[model samples]
Each structure stands twice: as structure tokens, then as C-alpha cells.
Target chain A: MEALVASAVAVMTAVGVYLILRRQTFPVVLGMAMLSYAVNVFLFATGRLVVNMPPVLSDTATGYTDPLPQALVLTAIVISFAMTAVVVLLALGSFIASGNDGIDLGEDRE
Target chain B: MNHWIIAPVVLPALLAPLLVLLARNDLRAQRMLSGAGTVGFAVLAAVLLVQASAGGIGVYRLGDWPAPFGIVLVADRLATLMLALTAALALAVLVHVISTGWDARGRHFHALYQFQLMGLAGAFLTGDAFNLFVFFEVLLIASYGLMIHGGGRARLRAGVQYVVMNLAGSVLFLFALGTIYAVTGTLNMADLALKAAAVPAAEAGLLRVGGVLLLMVFAIKAALVPLQFWLPATYASAPGPVAALFAILTKVGVYAILRMVTLVFGAGSPAGDIAGALLLPAAGVTLMLGMIGVLGARDLGRMAAFAVIGSVGTLMLGVAIFTPAATGAALFYLIHSTLVAGAMFLVADLVRGQRGGLLLAPGPRMANHGMLAALFFVVAIGVAGMPPLPGFLGKLLILDAARSAPTAWAIWAAILVGSLLAVAGLARAGAAIFWATNDDASPVPSQPLALAGVAGLLVALAALTVAAGPVSGWLNATAEALYAPAPYIAAVLGGGAP
Candidate 1:
């Protein structure tokens, strides 16, 4: 199971990086979303793989997965969404203002 | 749980909507209300400092839940110090903005400014890693609005780039935080410190990999060299108070790195020498590169931005070296840099107003007033780490700590070269603007507003530097607490020996 999860992570990271390198704003935005999800899932797995146990506290079970990771990942997910929304707006705003939405928004520093 | 830990987080957020409603009719009423709210925040910050001191680690669980299960707002000495500084800077900006009459009550500016303060306070006081991200976004949102205020073309262009760059950084930041979560299974910084340190040897490398990724993202924000390109341009073009405000934002990134490094990856932890070595070189390079930039820049705004960069380099040098004195230097320099950079930005705004900014094409009213030019000259010298200033004292501590190291000579050389070059550059700018024969003075309007604020800040800086003994004593305590992470970890982890 650990091997399977790790493999999935590797694939996701590769795809995300490739998309991030693309020369268009929309693809880059999509890449960020994919990358954020893969990251959150991967981080949740770092506490070590656990099965049939959720992070929620219950009376019967001795313990579930680590709750700290859960709390953090949840917040990361929410903030990432906010970030995604902002980036999309910026890309749209750039397009409306400049009539071009290339991938290199401000990569060159002068 | 003392509410002090969390009130600053919620107050502006809750009060902003209220302000939008209350001040809709009366502009004077809005200014009064906003000023009162800011004062209230500063007072609450004081209470939180006291609570943090007594409780040792004030963790107020949001929604009445226990640690690692609910949202947490933690305030230790470190967090309290950051909170206190943030509050103080905001208050100072408030004074400057009001006295200068930079803006009237039109255009929802006061509300957004209030929200920005709240976000900064939240970022400082929040305990959980994810909450930190939330606060960062909160701050960024407010910042976007603040940057484009008054609708100047240059401001609009820079604001667009600034937002996009930070948005990208935010994405990477979340990804890094997520990576940490995947490995540690805990987001609470305290819990992660303990758990991450205890990971099995087989898995430690991967965990360290994640940690380094997170560190890199912060390094970018902290404007560590090789990742510090966006800073000067964006900061140079920003509005006066907004640029001053950004001085603290970079430190927030640096503070997060210092805290994360000391608490999450310090000695006796799974994170090893490789991590320390990785960061140490970046510090030296950042210092050198910043000096080079300062040497080459022609414009006043851009030059001040490089000075801010140079200050950050000094800070990174202290933290990366990882000694008691070095860490203390880092902490002290952090405070000094934020204040000095802030004051310099204010100076830039004033100088630019008279000369009409840094375009080579001369404005009709090209620096008719000598007062502001002289004032900025002294400030530029002070910020260059020249004699009898806070920056000089801060650099001395860094050099003292680095004296015995192999890289000591290089850092010393960089510090000297950087300061001297900046002095030459800014003095040239001063000579051209202030001392040159006035062929076409045009009688520039008096820039009394920013000049007064800069003058006050410079005097305060002089006092701090001159009285370095007692100030250094207080700073030494801050330094000791920062480098030695055992106590901090012990407090949050509930009595286990770190």
C-alpha cells in the first residue's frame, strides 16, 4: 500500500511540474491545483500509513491517525482554494487588461 | 485560555464589515473609528504579551477544543515579540499617514488598511502552520487593495506583478506545508517538532526533503539570494506606507524560517548537518549579491530596496550560522531592519515626490527643496550601516559572532563593501539632488510630511544605536531564546525533554 501511494505521488508531482512549465496561464493554474492536492495527500501520509482509522477522536478506538496532520492538511486545502481563486482572477485581469495571458507572468526581473 | 492570543486575529476581521457600515456616511467618524480600533489592537497585543509571559505558551483553542484537534492561536515569547513589533509598526504608519494626510476618507481605504493589520497580527500570533498560510492569504488580499490605492499607473503595473508573484509563492507555500503534513501527520508546530524528530532512520531523509522544500519557499519570500528578484522592483514602485509595511512582511518570512528551523530541525533532531550547511551558504551569497545590487542601482527607491535586501542578508547570516550570539544578532537585526527599511521607504516617497521619481528624463520641478534631500542623505547613510547607527551595531554583533568561522572574513568583507558602496551611491544621489546648482528649481512644494516621520525614526534609531549596551542586553535575551530551542519545544510539547 505504501509503495502504491508513493508511486501515485511521484506521478502526480511529475505531471504537475510539467504543467507548471507550460506557456499558458490556465494550464499553470490547473497545475497548481493538482500539485496542491497531491501535496496535501502526501503530507497526510507522512505520519506513516494507517488503515481503517480516521483522525476524529472516538471512545472505542485506542487511537486513530495523527490529528495534527489532519488539522494542517484541512487548512492547507482551504487556503489553496483561496489562492487558486485569486490566481485565476489575476490571470483574467491580466488578459482583460493586456489581451495576452502567457505563462511567464513576471519571470524576468529588470 | 486567554482570549488575548486570538482577539487580534478576529477583531479586524469582524470589525472591518462593521466599519464599512458605520463609516459609510461620515468620513471623520470612519477615521476616528479606525484609529480607535488600531489602538485597541495595540492594547490587546500588550495584554497578549503579558499572558504569553505568564502562561509560557499561550494556546487558545478555537471553538473550545484541545491541541492538535482544533484551530490554535499560540503566543510564546517569540510570537509575542513579533506581535508587539507588528502592532508598533502599524501604529507608527498610522501616525505618519494621518499626519501627512496621505489619504482622506474616500475609497474604502481605512477598512482595507485595518484588515491588513489584522492579517499581520494573525500571521504572527497563530500557532498552527495551516493557520499561518490562512493569515498570509488574508494579508495578501488586503495588500493587493492597498497597493493600488489612489490609482497611479506605475502602482497598478507593479501591483499586478506583486500579486501574481506572491500568488505563485502562496501556491508553492501550501504545497510545502502539505508535504510536511504528509510526512509528519501533524500540523501543530509543537507536535510536528516532536514527531518529526522521532521519525525512524529509514524515513528521515524523505522527511528532511520535505522540510527543505518548505525552507526554500520561505527563502524565496525572505528574499534570500537566487530567489530575491521580485523584491526591489515591486517594493520600489509601491506606495509609501505600503512599502514601509512590506518591510515587516519579509521579516515575517524570515521569522517563520528561524522559528521553523530552530524548533523543527534544530540539534538532536532528525534533521541533521546537511540542512544547516544548505542554508549557510545561501546566507553568504545573499549578502554578497545584495551588496552588488546596491552598488549598481541608480534610483532612490530601488537603492533603498537593496539596502533592505542587505539587511535581510545580515539576518540570514545570523540564523544560518546557528550560534547563540548569531541567533541573537539575527533577531536584533530583524527588528532593526524592519524599522530602518520602513523609515527609508518613507524617505523614498518624499524624495520621489520632489524629483518626480527615478526616470532619467528630468521633471520640471526637479528637487527644488534641499531639506528633504539632506534628510534622505543622512537616512541613506544610516541605513548603509555607517557609524553611530542601529544598523552599524547590528552588523557588529553579526561580525563578532562570525569572527572565528572560516567564512568570517568573507562576511566581514561583504559588510564593509556593501556599506561603503551604498554610502557612495546614495551620497551621489544626494549631491546631484541637494547640492547641485539650481538651474531650474521650479520651487518644489515642501515635502514636510514624510520628512518629519523619517526624521523621528532616524532619531529613534540613533538613540537605539548609541545606547547599545542596555538595548543589547535585552536583545541578547531574545537571541538566547531564539537559538536554544529546548525550552520552546518543551513548553509546547507538554513536559517531554526536547
Candidate 2:
């Protein structure tokens, strides 16, 4: 399970990095979204990936999984969602104003 | 148990939403509320500063939970001093924006400004690592709104770059946090400090990787050399008051570096030593590159932006030394640089308004050229670390502290030469703006309130100079507190072994 999670994160990060290097704004935004997903997964996996276990204690069970990583991941997911929304609007605004999807500035064109 | 430690964060947080809902369309009311709130904040910060300097470390835990399990806000001398500086800077920038009517240019300016203040205060006061990241996003998103507040092509372009770069840095922050948490099973700074030294030898590699990644995140935020490509464009393009407020943003990076390094990885730790060794050379290069950027700048705003980057480099140089005296000097320099950089940005706006542009070429004579020229000269001298100002004293302290370090000579040469180059670059810009003859253009009228804001900041700089003796003593004590994490650790973890 850990191996699977690790490989998934690696693949997502690789693709995200590749897309982020693209010149188009939409792709870069997509890239960031992908990267954030990778990060969230990585954070989630920090609790050692226990299966068939509750995240709470009820005084009946011998043990339970660490719930902190789950909480952290949830917070990260919400923040990254907000980040993506903001970036999308910004990129869209920039595209509409300049009539181009390229991220380069006017001076850089010259 | 003190509630005041949380007020700096809570007041702004509550006021921001109220401004958005209650005073959305009422600009006058919005300004009044924000101004009042900021003044209140400043007063609170001053009180906190007094309390902290008197050797009180206030730790407020949310829901009255124990330290390692709950969100906490720690206000020692260092945090309160930073809080005070942030409040003071926010007040000045608020006045400037109100005076210049810069807030009218964008939607939700008051709300965003208040939120930005909340984020800064929260970041400075929060004792939990994850909460710091949350506050970072709060400040960052607000800054993105403010950066393009005026809505121009240049701002849009720069704003996109700035947002994307910081987003990447945020991801890095998450990864670092994950690594640290996985290795140590805790995120509370004091708890981490206790656990950091006990990390098993087998996990040392992971800890070092996490430490380095965290440093890189801060390095990006501080705009150190390779990671600084976005700063010049962003700062130069942002609205005047927004740029001015951002003067403290980079210091947030430096503040985090100092806090984390001193608490979690103090001197004598292998990770601490490695981070310091890495930071010194990078700081030197950042200083050199920033000076070159200053010299090569084509406009006053861009020059000011580069000078800010250079100042960060200088602050980091002192930080790299990792001595109490050096850290104290860095703290002093940190305060001075934030003021001078903010003043420079405001001055850039004044100059830009007068000449109708910030370009380096000779322009028409300003209406009040003499007064503006004097302001420029004094601010320039301060920024370049010349005499009769706090900047000079801060630099002397840093240089004096560095004399005992192994790279003392290199640090000395870089700072001295950097100051000289800054002077030359600023002088050239000053001469072109104020001295050169151009008869075709009419003088631009100055805004009284805006001028007052700039003058107010200059007065604060002067106050910093006059109060240097007591201020340095406080900072020295703060530095001592930072190096001796026993008090901090005990306060956070209920008097456990440090």
C-alpha cells in the first residue's frame, strides 16, 4: 500500500512539473492543481498508512491509527482548492486582457 | 493565558469580514474603521512589546487545550517586536493608501488590507507549524488581490508570475512539513525542538532533507538570488501602498528562518550547522546579485525593489552567523530595512507622480522639488547604510558581529561594496529625477496625506535611530531568548525537560 501511494505521488509530481514548465497559462494552472494533489497525498501518507483501523479511540480497541495526518491533509486540500480557484480567475483575467495565453510579459516578447 | 497575544490576529480577522459585509460600499466608513482598527492594533502591539520586553512569554492555547495537541500563539520578545513592527508599518501604509486614494482603485481593498494584516499578525504569533502555513496563504492570497489592485497589463503579468512562484513554494512547504511530521510525529515548534535532537541516527538523513527544503522555501520567500526572479517585476508593478506594505513580507521569510532555526535547530546541532553553512555563501551571492540588479535597474521603483532584495541579503548574512549578537544585529537591521524599503517605495510613487513616469531619464522639475529631494537624499542615505541613521548603526553592528566569524572578510567586503554600489545607483536616479533640466512638462501636484504618510515613516526611522540604545538592548535580550530555547520549550510543553 505504501509503495502504491509513493509511486502515485511520484508520477503526479513528475507530470505536474512537466506541465508547469509549459508556456501556456491553462496548463500551468492545471500543473499546480496536479502538484497540490500530489502534496496532499504525500501529507496523508505521513501517518504510516494503516488499513481497517479507526482514527478515534473508544476505550474498547487496542489501538487506532494517527488521525493528525488526515486532519492536516483535509486542511491542505481546502487551501489548495482555494489557491486553484484564485489562480484560474487570475489566469483567465490575464488571458482576456492580453488576448494571449502565454505567460510572458510584453517586454519579454521583445 | 493572556488573551492580548491573540488580539493582534483576532481583531484584524474579525474587522476584515465586518468591513466586507457592513461597509462594502462606504469608502469613508471603511477607511475610518480600518484606520481605527490599525491604530488600536498598534497600541496593542506597543503594550505587547512592553510586556514582552519585561520578560513575559505569553502562550495562548485555543480551546484551552494542552500545548502539543492544540493551536497555540506564543508572544515572547521576538514575536511581539515583530508584531509591533507589522502594526506600525500597517498603520503607516493605511494612512498612505487613504491619503493617496489608492484603495478606491480596486474592489474590497479595505477588506483585503485588513485580512493581510490579520495574516501577518497570525503568522508572527502562531506557534504551530501548520497554522503558520495557513497564515502564509492568507497573506499571500490577499497580496495577490492587492498586487493587481489597480488592474493594469503590467500588474496582471507580474501578479501571475508572483502567484505561481509562491504556489510552488507553498507546495514545497507542505512537503517539508510532511517530512518533519513523519520523522518527529509533532508539528508544535517547541515540541519539535525537543524531538529534533532525539531523532534516531537512521532518520537523520530525512531530517536534514526536511530542514534544507524548509530553508529553500524561506529562501524563495526572501528572494535570495536564484529564487528572486519574481520580486523586481512584482514589487515594481504593484500599487504604491501595496508595494510599501510588502516591505515586511520578505521579512516574514527571514522571521520564519530565524524562528525555526533558533528553536528547532539551534547552534551545535548538525542540521543547524549545515543550514548555516549553506546560508552564508548564498547570502553573499544574493547581496552581490542584488547590488548588480540595483545598478542595472531602469526605473526608480525597480531600483527600490532591488534594494529591498539587497537588504534581505544583508539581514541573512547576519543570520548566517548564528551568534546572539549577530542575530540581535540582524533583528535591528530587519527593522531598519523594512522602514527604509517602505519609504523608498512610497518615495518612488511620489517621484513617479511628479514625472508622470518612474523611468530613469531626466524629467521635468517637480513642483516641490526641494522638499522631495531632501526626503530622497535622507532616505537614500539610510537605505545605503550611510551615517546619521539607524541603517548605519545596524550595519556596524552586523559588521562588528561578523568580525569573529570564519567568513568575516567576505561578509565585510560584500556589505561595504554593496552599500557603495547602492549609493551610486540611488544617487544617479536622484540626480536624474531632481537635478537634470527639462522644461516641457508641468509639475504634478502632490497629495498632502500621501506626503504625510511618507514623512511619518521617516520620523519613525528617526525615532528608531534615537531609541537605538534601548531598542538594541531589547533586541539583544530577544536574541538571547531565541538562543536559549529552554524557556520557550518549557512554556509550551508545561515545564518538561528541554
Best by lDDT: 2
Interface RMSD, candidate 1? 4.5
Per-residue CA lDDT of model 1 for A1-110, tens digit only, reads: 99898888788878877887687778877877777777777766766778888677788886688666665677768877877787677667656655666744364322
**Model 1 CA deviation exceeding 4 Å by range:** A1-12, A22-24, A40-74, A98-110, B24-27, B47-57, B99-106, B152-154, B360-368, B442-444, B495-498
- Weakest ten-residue segment in model 2 chain A by summed lDDT: A101-110
Top DockQ hit? 2
Clashing pairs in 2: none
Model 1: native contacts recovered, as a fraction: 0.28
Question: Can you tell me the CAPRI class of model 2?
Answer: medium
**lDDT tens digits by residue: candidate 1, B1-498:** 566677887778877787788786666776787788888888888887777555476667677666665566768777887787777677667766665566562377778888898888888877678778788888888888777666554555555666656766776776677666666767777778778888888777877777777787788778888778778877876777778878888888887887787768776667575546777778777877776676677676777788778778878877778777887776777777787888888877765666666532334444436666666766776777776667777888888988876788777877777677777766666665566544666556674554656766776677777777876776677667766666665555453221
